[model samples]
Target: MGWMRRAKVARDDPDSTGATNTVNEHQINNEGQRSNINSLPNELLLLVFYDAIQSHDNCSAVLAVTCRRWRNIVIHEPKFWGSILLGSCHPLGKYRLWTMRIGTHSPPRRISLIIRGGPSVYIEPEWIQLFDALKARTYTIQSFHFHGNSESLSWANLRMGGFLCEEIYLHLDDRLSMNSSISAALSEPTWPTPYPPPLENSISPKILSFRQA
Candidate 1:
């Protein structure tokens, strides 16, 4: 529910960085004086966008839809899209549009993805396309969180041999399902042999916390 609420609360804020900018609020909005918020320098605007995005993972759409200038900046800035929130029930058309807008302009980089899926829901083609696209980013994924039943979790095509991800959280319907999924993943030749790299200290503690419904 928190994840869903995040998507809902993300609104386009024209003045995302209220007091952080050198420009004062009055100067930003002087009565009777025409003021174009887009007039801010590109560097400053990017800072604002980054801050907003960091604060709210769902702010990508809000930033892109703010105005043409901001939209262009958001589309071209790979850093602004480092974090992505994917939900199974989220409209595919809308998600596809946003991903295309953000991904086409720059070379893919590491991403922090928070994905929500469930066994009861059908996976959309767009979801598959999205996963493939992210996979093509190579080993740059820094973190991945999957919340779903075994059936839905299996749909996550994370077969790349190596990952830069330091955090991996798998929340599943039960321990049995989780074990089966891990076994299946490990059996895949493309997966790292040791699975999470046997020596990685951070992984053991975090992985043991996997949720069981």
Candidate 2:
């Protein structure tokens, strides 16, 4: 986070006098000029930010705090916080906050989630709420992955309610399997068609959930 705010400087200053003169000239010429990123269009910046995230070159949080405009763009864009990994060590509402931020509204976004719970995290109450929230927005989910111990597996009660997910991977201990009850409950896909930007008057931003597990 701190590094994002710092400007890079060359260590090989050929001459102290020349460097000072260059700095003075640069400041005089560009004092009122916006940085390259700031000068870019919002749409371009969004694309740049997305590329940076995909390439692991930048973090949204750091980008947001770097400048007011970037913060406004990063915070409002649901995709900026799309993918998430929640573990037993994380608090409850925090998960809820991330989900809320990755909203179900337009500029269609998909989420990839990886949740882990340990033996000590016995059936958290928020587990129900978390799944309920996901269930409600199953249409926005692209991938759902889980890894945890058997004792805590019971908390993973995600209903595929009209979920158009491309992947759903679950693992307990070392074995990979889907719960019979959840599989049996797979009903006819009943999710609403994410209306197109024009169709739903939802023409909006771009976003997708991506996380590091």
Candidate 3:
């Protein structure tokens, strides 16, 4: 995830030369000699990160760039990345790279790992591809939340599969028919979709919350 630093540098200084800021292994200890955060043990550091990033979709990337020590900690501990954001404005490559942190053999989640789509969601192929690439509940999600317009969901092609999910929550705008929206979301057995035909290998979830806001 050290690559995130380069990505940040490139984004902040897009027109400049392509060279990225090199990571300093001693940066944390050297730069913040008097900082309390610097004194916390590795166990405490994990607790701090979990609390700081539970609401963030890109916790791993954000924490990785803080320092080499923190980056190494996040890379080895996958649970820190359980909460992921969807339909984000970040480039598709970044999302694809993010998925590399999750795998089948990873640790069991005490609670559901969430994937949420914000109001900023674009609902295009890029968004669809992002969800499709998630694999499903077993290799990926356990809970889901989406907030966007109905027309946007018309383009969704999610294929739900893998392990059963605990919940599916959607908050959609009232511009289109509710049936259209739910059909799209319930299409795939594991992935998100608007209105695709029923398929095999699916599990029933607890609830589907559809609200107009």
Task: Put down candidate 1 lDDT per residue, 71-178, tens digits, no spaces.
Answer: 898878766776666664453555456556556444333233445545434445666666655546533445566566555544453432233355456656545533
Question: Which scores greater on lDDT, model 1 or model 2?
Answer: 1
What are the RMSD figures for all models against the true structure? 11.8, 11.5, 10.6
User: Candidate 1, which segments miss by more than 4 Å at Cα?
Assistant: 1-39, 89-123, 132-139, 157-164, 170-213
Q: What is the C-alpha lDDT of each candidate?
A: 0.52, 0.49, 0.54
- Write down the TM-score of every candidate: 0.48, 0.47, 0.56
lDDT of 2 by residue, 96-162 (tens): 6665666775443333334554544445666555666665653444554545543343344323233
The number of the candidate with the highest lDDT is 3
- What is the TM-score (0 to 1) of candidate 2? 0.47
Q: What residue runs in model 2 are displaced by over 4 Å at the alpha carbon?
A: 1-41, 55-62, 65-67, 78-82, 88-92, 99-104, 107-117, 136-140, 150-154, 158-164, 170-213
- Candidates sorted on TM-score, descending: 3, 1, 2
Per-residue alpha-carbon lDDT of candidate 3 for residues 20-107, written as tens digits (9 for 90 to 100): 4333434555467737676889999988888887666566678888788889988777777665554446545665555567553454
The predicted structure with the larger TM-score, 1 or 3, is: 3
Model 2 pairs whose backbones collide: 83-209, 83-210
Q: What's the ranking of the predictions by lDDT, best on top? A: 3, 1, 2
